[model samples]
Every structure is written in C-alpha cells, then in structure tokens.
Target chain A: MAAEVVASTVEIAAASQVGMKALGAGLAVGLTGIGAGVAEMGIGSAAVGATAENKDLFGLVLILTVIPETIVIFGLVVALVLWFV
Target chain B: MLAPEKMSRLLIVASKDQLAPITGALYRSRLFHIEDFVVEGREGYDGFSIGKPLAGASEASGGLIKVRSLENVFAIRPDDIDPAGARKRHDDLARVVDRELAKIGTEVEGLTSRRSKLEASIKEYEQRIHEITPFADIPVDLSLYRGYERFAVIAGFVTKNVAIREPAESRIVKGKSSNFIVAVVPNEDRADVESELAGAGFVASPIPAESGMPHALIDDYQAKITQAKAEIASIEMNLDAIRQKHADFLVACEEVLKSEVEQAEAPLRFATTDQTFVAEGWVPSSRIAGITDEIMKASGNRAYVAELPIGPHDVVPVEYNNPSFAKPSQFFMNIYARPKYTEIDPTLMLSIIFPIFFGLILGDIGYGLILLALCFALRKYFRGEDAEYFLKVIRNASISSIFFGVLNSEFLGFAMPWWPPYSFSRHLISEHGGHGPMIPELLLLAIWIGILHITLGRVLGMVNHYRQDHGEHRMKAVLANAGWLFVMWGVLVIIWSGIVMPLMPDLTGFPMLVAIPGLPMDIPGINVTMVLGGIMILAGVIFIARDSILEVVELPSIISHVLSYARLVAVGLSSVAIAMVVNFISIGMLIEPQLENFTLIGAVVILAGVVVFILGHALNTALGILGGGLHSIRLNYVEFFTKFYKGGGLKYNPFGLKRRFTED
Candidate 1:
C-alpha cells in the first residue's frame, strides 16, 4: 500500500509541473507585451509629431517608432524557450 | 576609406578682370563647394562686400525662365533627352529659340483659346438640351408657354399630384423621378393656383427661348458638340506636332541657359572690392592641386590660389569615399546621420551586417525569392534621388535571406526536402509541422552576435576618440571605451559559465565554457572563468568611473544591449509561426476538407482557399519586410551606433551644376 501511494503522488506531481510550465510561459509573453507597449506609447506620439513637421523625416521616424517593438521580441523568445526549449 | 573624403579649404584672390575665366573654370570643373559671403554682416570683412553677378545674370535668368516655360509645355526634361548633334553658339541658340518661341506661342495660344471658347459654348448648348428634354412630352411650343397676357402660367415639375380648383387649366406630364406640370390661370386667381401647386411640392424647370421641337433642338446641339470636339482634336494634333518638331531644340536651349545662369550667378557667393574678388570654398584635398593648376592656366597666371588651414571644429562638408559595392549602404548612414568628419564611418559595417540580420529574421526560401522579385519590380518605380541605394540594399538583404533560409531548412515555414527527418535538432524547422525546439540555441547564437557587434562598436569608439580628442582627454576617452568592452566580455563570460552551460546546452561540439586552470580554480564553488570575469568587471568599472562617475550608472545598458539581439531570433520565429499558421488554415482547414468531399460547392470553397492562401501569405510577407528591415537597422542605430557614432556631418554640395545634357 505504501509503494502504491508513493507512485500515485509522483504522477500527480508530474501533471502539476506541466500546468506550472504553461503558466510561466504565458506570464513571460503577457508581461513583456505590456512592457513593450508602455515603451512604445511615448515614442509613437513623439514620432508622429516630428513626421508631421518635416515630411522627409518619415524614414527616420519609422525607425524610431519600431525600436521598442524589439522588447516584445525578447518576451516572445523567453516564452518560446519556456514552452518548447 | 573608413572615414569621409578628406576636405581642404581653398581660398582664391584674383584681379576683378580674371573673375570670368576663374568662374568658368570652377563651373566646368564642378569641384568647388562655395561658402557664400554674407553681404550685410558686420564682421571682420574690412572693405570687402558680396560681389555683383558677373555680367549677364539678369538676362540669362530671364532666358532660363523662357526656355523652361517652353520646355515645360513641351514636357522636356534634361534627363529625358540626349544633347543634339552640333552644339550651337550661345547667341545663335538664343536667337533661334526666341524666334521659334514667338511663333509657337502665338499659334498655340490662339488655338488653345479658340478650343476653350468652343468647349464653353458646347457646355451651354448641352445644358439647354437637358432643360428642354424634360419638356419633351409636352406638345406646347416654347412661345405659347411664355407669352401669356392677362393669364398666369406656372410651369415646373411636381413631386405629388394635386388637384387644381376652377380658374386654372392643369396639364401634367408624369415622369420617373418627378412629374412635369403646367398651369394656366386667370391673373386674379394666380395666388390660389400657386398655393395649390406649392402644397403639392412643385419645382420649376425653365423653358428655352428658342422655339423648336425638343428632338430637333437636341439634334442641332449634338451636331454643334460634334464639330467642337473635332476642332479640339485638331488643336491637340497641332500642339503635338509643334512639340515633336521643336522638342530637341528646346532641350538644348534649356541646358545651355541653365549653365549660363549658374556660371553668371557664381559671384553672388564671392567676396569682392572694386578692384579684386576673393572666393573661399572646400575641395577634395587630393583634387585641390589639379583644380589650382587648371584655374591658373585658365586665368593666364592672374589668379592666386592658396590652401587655408582648417580649424579643429570647422564645418567640413562630408562626401563618402566608399567602394562601389558598399556605396548603397551609405543610404542607411545618411538616414540615421552621416558620420562626423573625424569619426570612423560605420557604413561599410552596416552594409555587411544589416542584411545578415534581416536574412536571419526573415529566413525562408519563399519569402526571399518573393522579396527579390519585389525589389526588382520596385526598382523602376522609386526613381527619386536615392532610389538605387534603397533598391540595392533590399536586394542584398533578399540574397542573404535565401542563404540563411537554406541553412534553416525552411521553405515558407514548412520543412524543405533536404530537411533531415531523423536529426530534428540539426535544422531550425521540425518535421511535425511547426518551429523546432532549437529556439534557445538560436537565442544564444543571437547573444553571441550581440557580443561581437558591441565589441566592434566599442573598438571603433576607441579609434574615434584617439583621432578626435586632443591630449589627456584622448587617453581617458579610449580607456572609457576599453572599459565598456571589458564589461561586455566579462558579462558574457559570466553568463556563459553560470547560465548557458547549465540551463541550455543543445550543441555538444560547440566551442564555449572551457575551464582553464588558474589561481581561482582552487575555490570550491567558483571556477577560473568566473574569477577572471569578476576581476575584469571590477577593473572595467573603475576605468569607466575614472572618466565620469555618472557613467557607471549606464553600465547595465551594455548587458541589456546584448540581450537586445535576442530579438533577432524571436522576431524570425514569430514570422515563421505566422506563415505556418496561414498555410495550415488555408490548406488544411479550407482546401483539404473540400477535396475530401469534392462537389460543385467544393470548387468555390477551393477557390476561396486559394485566395485566402495568397492574401494571408501577402500579409505575412509585408510584415516580414517591415519587421526584418526596421528591426535589423534599429539594432544598429540604438545598440551598436550609440556605442561609437556621433554623426553631424553636412553633405558636400558643390557650387556648379552636374551637367546631364550640355558640357562646357
């Protein structure tokens, strides 16, 4: 009876481990997405204002606006690593 | 080659009489970048003032305007036509062009005015025909409707049908949108008739003054319109013939006049006195000798040319002297900010690295080929000043994508035929139809890239500081750059031994984490790499603080910048996922099910599936371009460039014209 109880407990622990891993991956992506959005809000508004003034600044403005988006990439990698790697 | 082309300041002092030949020489050589003299300035100019335009500046400018107007009407651009054979002398060309201009002007202007008048008359006739058509069904003539004595006539279309009381005879013609109505009543009961009609929501349509059958009038107007149109066509034909006959002449005249205007106006930028003229400008250092010799020969030894010493912070107009292939990459540097005169130009490095990053992120054979075709197709459309530069950069990037795509074994997010079925870890794609579990390894690879890229920037920073800085400050600037490098490598070593080895080790044969024997090896829990890493970090921190204590606060930025390269892998994987999802939805969810139960409706469904497939991939491709291009360059600008670059260079715009049609 003792041996059967120990094996059953091991099976329960394994199931919970998967659930925890999924939760961790979800958090990683969600929080990073929020962080990236916060970073971009300030830059996006400033870029639009600058572009409005000088039409030729369109190329430079585009690069500035997308810089924060790379932060989300970091989050995505972390999430993928948690789930798959 | 790594820096901007060397610029030497050129100052010229010539007798007032020699201005013509010297100006001509400068204009023809196209080597001078003039610094305009400020006429109103109260500086140390002494008696010198801005020189008057050489001689025929006003006359040349007026001729230019006339030639350009003719050129514009004829739609002739400098680049559109080649220089005609046997160039004419200026006086002859001007006389000929002016005579032709007068003849063409009178003929073309008269024809145009006549055509416009005919068009206006046609519009009026057409309007009359439309107004009369509404009254077509009414048999009453125009005279009978208008000349009513001792009777009131209300004629218009009405919305709702209304009954009229006694004294008015109502004639109604019903039509599609509204009904045409005419009421004739005694003059005494006119108000009553008007009130009744107004209650039914009446609208008025004026009858034409001419008395004729509606059909007859329409036929007459139509004949007139047809004649007018024929005349207009003849006018167009005449104009086109004129354009064809004199197109080459107009182009030649315009080129000569433009050059004349440029050369005549050259003295506006020169400082002058009553007796002599002085000009100052920058020329390429190597070309200065050649230009001086030419100017001396042209002026018959009357002009004196001297090279002035450039100050430390003097404004130097930078012209890049990159190799032919690397020329296109200067577009990116120009966009961000051109490098300073004394600074190291990172354009070549950007040219080589940015494409690799783009390819790595958008690595798929299908996307690569599509982009290649797109770049080729778009090459013709973007003919602005920098179109070739943009197209070449994109083409290089597309080729890189193909190379990286083959290594990734991904053909539009699906496993390629060469993708190893047994060895799942070898390729970036999985046989099971999704991204592989090698994402961590890719991320690590990106980190390594970051490390090397940042290291190069830091080293360049050292070189820039050594070159630009004066004395003691130079040593400090270089040491500060060295400190950053130390911190970057030390952090990488620490992470490699402490984190990468223990947590993510996919490749067994990869080179890293080789523990060498050292004094710190005896420590129970610590290794030599970690000990060395700690010492380096400490030394780096001290060196950095020595330059500016506040700079130590930015130390973590180096570590974060390294982590920023993780985006290279993360972004690519996201693109792959999108492509795969699109493929799965269109082929599996849409097409495959319809094929299983093929029917008449199934054909439509399959068509929809194909459209969905194409549209979805199109969306993915656009995103791939934006993500791959912007993010890849952003890494260079924000991470790599910040370490070294301080760009505020002006472009070298020489005073003379780069003649496309006429040569001096």
Candidate 2:
C-alpha cells in the first residue's frame, strides 16, 4: 500500500513535467511563427512588386521571400530541445 | 576555379575601306567583347563621329520587319521549326526571300480581308435577328410599327404586366426567368402608358424594318450565321496550310536577314573619320592570337591590330573559369550576380559545400533514392531549360544523402533492420533496441559545422581583402577579417570552458589543438582555455574597432549565425518525425491490428493504410526537398557570401548572331 502511494505521486509529478514542457514547446513555435509572418509580410509585397516590374527577379524574390522562414526553423529546434532534452 | 578568365584589351585600326572585312572577321571569331566607342569631343576623337552602316542596312532591316510580320500572322515560333531539319537550298537568298515574302503577304491579306467581311456580315445578321427576336412573339407587321404618324408603339420585356390605362392593345408573354410584354397606345396616351410600363421595369427595344413572319426570319439568319462560321474555319485552315508549307523558308529568311542587318549596323558602334576608323574591344588572352590572325587574314594586312595595356580600373567582362563539374552551380551564382574579374568566383566552393549541407538535412535511404529517380525523370522533360542545371545540383545532393543515410542507418523513418550504428531520433533510446534521442550530440555537431563554415568564410574574406585593398588599408581590412574569427572563437571557448563543461559533462567538447598527435602539451594551469579566451576577445575587439567602431555591434551576429546552422538538424528531425508519425498511424495503428482478422473490413483497413502511407510520405518528401534546398542555399548566400563575395561584373556578350534556322 505504501509503495503504491509513492508510485502514484511520482506519476503525477512526471505528468506535470511533461505537460509544462509541452506548453513551452508550443509557445516557442507559435511565437516564432508569428514573428516570421510579420517579417515576411513586408518583404513578400515588395518582392511581388519588383517581380512584376522585371520577371527575371522571380528567383531572387523567391529566395528573399523564404529567408525569414529560417527563423521559424530555429524556433522548431528550440522546441525539440525543450521536449526531448 | 577561383579567378575569372583573363582578358586583354585589343585595339584595331584600319583604313575606312577595310572596316567591313575587319568587322566581318570579328563577327566570325566570336571572341571579341566590344567596348563602345564614345564621341568625347576632344583631341583624337574630335573628327571621329559615329560610323554609319555600310551599304545595305536599311534594305535588310525593312525585309526583316516584313518577315517578322509574316511570322506573326502565321503565329510561327522558333520552336515550330527544327534546327536540324534539312532546308531547301536557295542559291540566291535575296531573290528567294523577296519572291516568297511577296507571294505569301498578298495571299494572307486577301484571305484575311475576306474573313473579316464574312465576320462583319454575320454580326449584321445577328443584330437584325436580335431586334426581331422580342417582336416575334407579337403577331404584328414590323413595318406598321415604324411608319405610323399618329400612333406610337412601346414594346419590350418587363418585370410584370402593366395596367395600361390608355386606349391601347397589349399582350404579355411570361418567360421562365422574366416577363415579356408588348403594348401599343394612342399618341395622346403614349407618354402616360410609357411611364406606367417604365414603373414596372420595362425596357423598349427598337423594331427592325423587315417584312416577314418572325420564326422563319430567325431561322434564315441562323443559317447565314452558320455558313459564315464555316467560311471563317475554311479560311483558318488555308492559313494553317500556308504555315505548314512555308514555315521553314520563312524562319530561315528571318534568321539570315537578322544576321545581315546586325552585321550591316555593326559600324554604328565604332569611331570613324573620312580616311580612317578605330575599334576597341576585349579579347580573352587565350584566344587573342587566333582572333588577331583571323582579323589580319581577313583584312589582307590592311588593318593594324594593337594589344593595349589594360588598366586596373577598366571594367573587363568576366567569364567563369570553373571545372566542368562545377559549371552547373553557376546557375545559383548568376541568380545572385556574376563575380567581378578581380574577385574570386565562389561557384566551385558552393558546388562542393551546398550538396553536403543538403545531404545532412535530407539524409534518408528511401527518400534519397526516390529523389534521385525523380531528378532523372524531370531531366528528360526539362531538357534544354535553365531548370536542368538546378536538377543536376539536386541529383548530386541526392547521392550525398544516400551516403549520409547509410551512416545514419535510416530507411524511410524506421531503424535499419540490424541495430543502427548512429541515430538522432528524438525519443528512441539504444537500451530499448531503438536508435537514439541523441539531441545534445547532434546539436553539438551542428555547432561545429557552423564554426568551421563561418571561419572559412572569414579566412576567404581576408584573402579577398588582401587582393582588393591597397597598402595600409589592406592590412587593416585583412586584420578585421581575422578579428571576427578571433572574437567568435574566443566567445565560444569561454562558453565551453567556463559555463557548459561544468554543467553538462556528456558533450565531449571540441578538441583544442596541441603540438603533436602523441604529445600532451602542458599549459599554464589556471583554466588556460578560459584565460586565452579573455585575451583573444580583448585583442579582437581592439583590432575590429580600428576599422570601424560600429562593426562591433555586428559581433553578436557571428554567434547567432553559428546557431542558425542548427536548422540542419532541426529540419531533418522534423522530416524524420513526420515519416515516423505517418508510419505509426498507417501501419501500426490501422493495418497491423486488422491484418490478423483477414476479413472484408480488414482488407478495407489495409487499403486505407496504404493510401495514408503514400500520401503522407509524399508530403514529407516534398517538405524535405524544399527545406533542405532552401536552408542550404540561405547559408551560402546570406552567411557565407556576406564575408568575401560582392558580384557586379558585366556579362561577356560578343557581337554575333546565334542562328536557329539558317546555314552558314
């Protein structure tokens, strides 16, 4: 009976720990995604206008459009670290 | 591989009459990139006005315009005529071009005019039919509606039937979607009746001056419309036949005339006088001898070719001088900018490094083999397109992925059949007979890669500064490059020795260099690595501040940029995670449980699992490619190129026509 009580308490602590890590991971990705979106908004519009003027700018514009996405990838790495490590 | 091809400025001077032969020789040599001769209005250039085109430039230009117009009329494109197709020989091209152009132009004009006439008649018949269509329901003579002096007829479709409180006769026909009403009122009540009808949303259409029964007239007009359409189709067929018969001759004519016009107008770019002419251009040093010989032979020793000394400040055109294997990466370099002649071309380095980064991210046996197959398949369809170069880069990357996949022991997202040697899987542990949750090790690996890549960039920056700057400035510039490296490494060492090692003992820190492989060198023992870190940071800050004070603000970027390479591990992990999740859902949860039953529902479950597996893996594959390719290129362009490369060199364009459908 004593051993069962200890095991139950340990399980509760583990559950809360996992839950907190999950929350932290969620915030990391969500906030960074928002940041990346804000960054891309201005660049994406300007890239479109430039591409309209010169179609050859399409490749450069595409690269520029995706550069901010790297920030989101960084966030993902952080989230993985929080969850796994 | 690093430097652009060397060029020498060449000057050609000749008597006015030898200009044509010299120009012709230059065109045929195809090695000279002409520098336009500006009229400076001083000294030797005072009498040297822009050269006029030789004899037949105008005539050739006019013929070219006609041929181009004929091409437009027939909608003929370069793709329509195969370059290798055996063309009919025209012994006298000028006569043949003129004769064919005249005959085809007249024929097309005649056919087009007839078609337009038919189309116009068809429109007229349609308009007459539209006016009579609404009136057809009313049994009235159309001439009686128009030629009345004392009576006015108001006839149109309406929303609802109006109570015409006038000495009037009215008929209402209700259609499916709307109501059609026609009314005729006395002249006195015409205004009143019209207002009442207008209140019901009545719109009046004018009657046509045709004296005939309604539906019969409509059928006659419809028949005429059908016949006119057939005539237009026949005319279009005749035009297509003409296109098929004359496509080769016409395209060839356009090519020959285009070449002639360009040759004739070439002199406009040269400086000339009544007695003499001068032309200046750059020729690749390797081809200078052959070109000079050709020019001399063509001019029959009449023109003088002089090799001019090229100054440091001259804008020499740059052609990349990479090995054949590295040539395809020029696709990326050109999208950014071609390197200047004075700077190193980064194509060779990019070709070597980019695929390795790609492999590190997309390393999976199943996906790698699939991508390799996909690249070859795409190459077949995209032949002769710019995309072919990009596809070649992806193919190389796929091979690298296969190599890394073997090392990682990943097949799809599952562990290899035997115990895998290495793993970066997020939750799997070796004790559980699974691969890994080796996050710390992979993160450390990413950091080391970042350090190596960034350091190489700084070292290249030093070399560039050494080549580009002058005297004292060169020293300072090169020192600044070194300073960035020193600061970055110093901060890294401090973090490792003072903070990280004491906290987590699992990460075996990067090895510091000692004297020899077998020798363990002793150091001044009070945490020597940390002390060295402090000293290096101090020295680096001083050196960087010597160049520009604000550059110190950018020092943090060295660390942040290093951390960014963590995406290599992160993106790959995400791809692996997706594949694992898909397999678990489709196979473990859906198919495996039902496989024992062997019932109809079991069969359905297996089919659904297969669909989910295919779709999910396909999605992951697409994501893998996009993430791997973009992140690798981003590191090169944003992080690496920022160190040493600044590309604004002029492209090497020689004055010669690239023909598509003409013979020499």
**Which residue pairs of candidate 1 clash?**
none
Candidate 1 has an lDDT of 0.82
Off by over 4 Å in 2: A1-3, A55-64, B41-44, B79-81, B87-95, B139-141, B383-385, B421-432, B499-526
TM-score, predicted candidate 2 vs. hidden true structure: 0.91
- Specify the highest-DockQ model's number: 2
What is the lDDT, from 0 to 100, of the residue B16 in candidate 2? 87
> Candidate 2 on B1-664: residue-level lDDT in tens?
7889998999999998997888878886778898888888434677788899988899889999999998998898866556767654433565578777889999998998999999999999999999888777777766667777778777787887667764698878777766777777778888788888888888776767888777788989999999999999999999999998988888889877877787788888898888888898888899989999999999898888989998777899999898988888998898878898889899999999999999899888889999999998997667454587889899999998887787777777876654545545533434347546677778878878888898989999999889988988899989998999889888877666544532233222434433223322322123557667878998898889998889999887887788888888888888888988898999999899998778998999999999999999999999999988988988888778888888888998887766666555
Error of 1 at B336 (Å): 1.9
Q: Give lDDT tens digits, candidate 1, residues B1-664.
A: 7889999999999999999999988887888999888777646678998888878888778877877876776677766565667665656775576677667777777877898898899899889888888767777666677777898777898899888877688888888988888788889998888887888888876767878777777788889999999998898898889888877767777767777888888888899999999999999999998999989999998898999999776789889989887899998888888888888988888889999999988888899999999999997677654788989999999999988888877777777777453222323446666545476567777888888899999999999999988888899989999998888777766555454343333232234345444535232244567667778888899889888899999997887888889888888888888888888888989899999989999999899999989998999999999989988999999888888998878889887776554445
Q: What interface RMSD, in Å and to 1 decimal, does model 1 have?
A: 2.1
Worst 10 residues of 2 chain B by lDDT: B501-510
TM-score of chain A, model number 2: 0.82
